[model samples]
Target chain A: MEITAIITALCLVLGSLLGITGGIGVYRLPDFFTRLHACGITDSACAFLILSGLMFQTGTSLETVKLLFILIFLLITSPTSTHALAKAALNSGETPLMEQQQTQQKREER
Target chain B: MLEAIYGASCLAILAVMGLALLRAVLGPSAFDRLMAVNMFGTKTVLLISVFGFLTGRPDFLDIALIYALVNFLGTIAVLRFFEGRKTPACYDEPAEEQKE
Candidate 1:
């Protein structure tokens, strides 16, 4: 039990660090698409770590089952939303920084 | 020991939440704002779950689960709404406006 508690604490701390990193990336990254990558880090990995940590604390119980459900739901939905957001951004003509640079280079060559 | 850890983690998550909010406020385009909002919602879900555990009420996991569902749907719905717009009004205006 003591070991499990220690592991749970570790997971929570690690997840917190990852989440903070993602948040900072979102805040400081140069472009919208780059920020999307940062958001994906928190949406997938950080959520997984934190929820799994909570599951470890719960052990075999209804609460564990609920946490598992939340974990799975987040895993599935987060990527979908990220994808949808990216697609919508593209459809709305938001060009990424890299692509803009490439086009500028092509025009200069021309 | 576990409780103290949980409390500390909760505070860290809250700080992250504030960072995400700052991004949303300072975001240059609509998509940037939307992405920040989505990230904010994700952190909110984590915050609720951790707080629930800190208070010894695991039942609050259900609320967290429901919140995850709503956040997903809300993001997608907003994306679809933006997709329907003919002109990219939100993106082009802000970048140019900020330049001046």
Candidate 2:
């Protein structure tokens, strides 16, 4: 029981650390696409860590099953949302920062 | 030990939420704000789940799940709204219209 508790604690800490880092990335990243990468970290790594920690605390139960379901649902939706956002941005003429830099470099070369 | 862990994690999550909120408010572009809002929603889901465990109320997990569902739907709807408003046909329109 104590071992389980320790593991849960570790998971929570690690998850929160990832979340904080992701948040900083969101705040400080240079471009929209880069910030999206930060959100992906939180959406995937942070969420999985936190949910698994909660599952450890709950043990084998219906709640655990539900938590697992949520994790799966989140894993599926987070990326889908990111993709949708990126597609929407691209469709609407939001050129990626990297691509812009490359085009500028090519023009300068000419 | 568990209580301490829960409390610390909650505080960390709150800090993250604050940063996300800052991004939402200060984001330079529509999509940036949109991404910030999405990130905020994700953190809120985490916060709710952690609170559930902290308070010994597993029922909050149900709430967290609902938030997750709502967040995803909300993101998709918002993005779709943007896409519809700025369809590729309008690509030749004024830059002013695209900023929205």
Candidate 3:
């Protein structure tokens, strides 16, 4: 019981910290792609951590089963949506900042 | 002790949600807002689950699942809406040519 508690605490705190950091990144990042990466990291890592912690707290039960389902669904959907969003942006001709910077650098070199 | 942890986690989630809200409001483009909203939805799932545990009712997990499904579908639908507008020429041109 004690060990589980300790682990749960660790997971919750670390996960939420990652989440907050991701939120800040989303707010501060200069472009859509960078912000998407930040959001992806938080969506996967933080969700895994928090859900796992909750799983530990719940022990063997139907709730734990539900948590696991949520985790799996999140893992699958978050990345797919991120990809779709990026693709849509690309289709719309939104050049990423990094690509623009590289082109500018090459022009300067020339 | 567990209660305190859950409480702190809830507070942290709330702060993160606030940041997401800021992004949603200040996003320069529709895609940016969409991404922010998607992220916000993910955070909401976590918040709801944490709250459920805090309140000693794990049934909220089901609601989180429902939210998760809706968020995914919502993003897809909105993105489709955006895409449809982008290339309406191809979608509408053939019909117009036939009409003429």
Task: Judge candidate 1 at residue B100 and give its lDDT.
Answer: 80
Candidate 3 is scored at a TM of 0.90
Query: How do all models score by TM-score?
Result: 0.92, 0.90, 0.90
Could you report the Cα RMSD, in angstroms, for every candidate shown? 2.0, 3.3, 6.5
Candidate 2: tens digits of C-alpha lDDT, residues B1-100: 8988988889999998999899888757778878888888888888988898889988878887887777888887777677667554343334656688
Q: Evaluate residue A64 in candidate 2 and report its C-alpha lDDT on the 0 to 100 scale.
A: 97
Clashes of 2: 0
**After superposition, which runs of candidate 3 have C-alpha atoms over 4 Å from their true positions?**
B87-100
For candidate 1, the per-residue lDDT at A24 reads 86
Candidate 1 local lDDT, A1-110, one digit each (tens): 58889889989999999998888888888999999988886768999999999888887999998889889988988898898888887887878989999999999999
Q: How much DockQ does model 1 earn?
A: 0.80
- What digit string (tens of lDDT, one per residue) describes model 2 on residues A1-110? 49999899999999999999999999999987888888886768899999899899887898998899888888888888988888788888878889999999999999
Model 2, residue A93: distance off in Å is: 1.1
**Candidates' C-alpha lDDT:** 0.86, 0.84, 0.88
Residue-level lDDT tens digits of model 3 in A31-98: 88999899988879999999999899988989988999999999899899999998988897777999
Identify the candidate with maximal DockQ.
Answer: 1
Candidate 3: residue B73 lDDT (0-100): 94
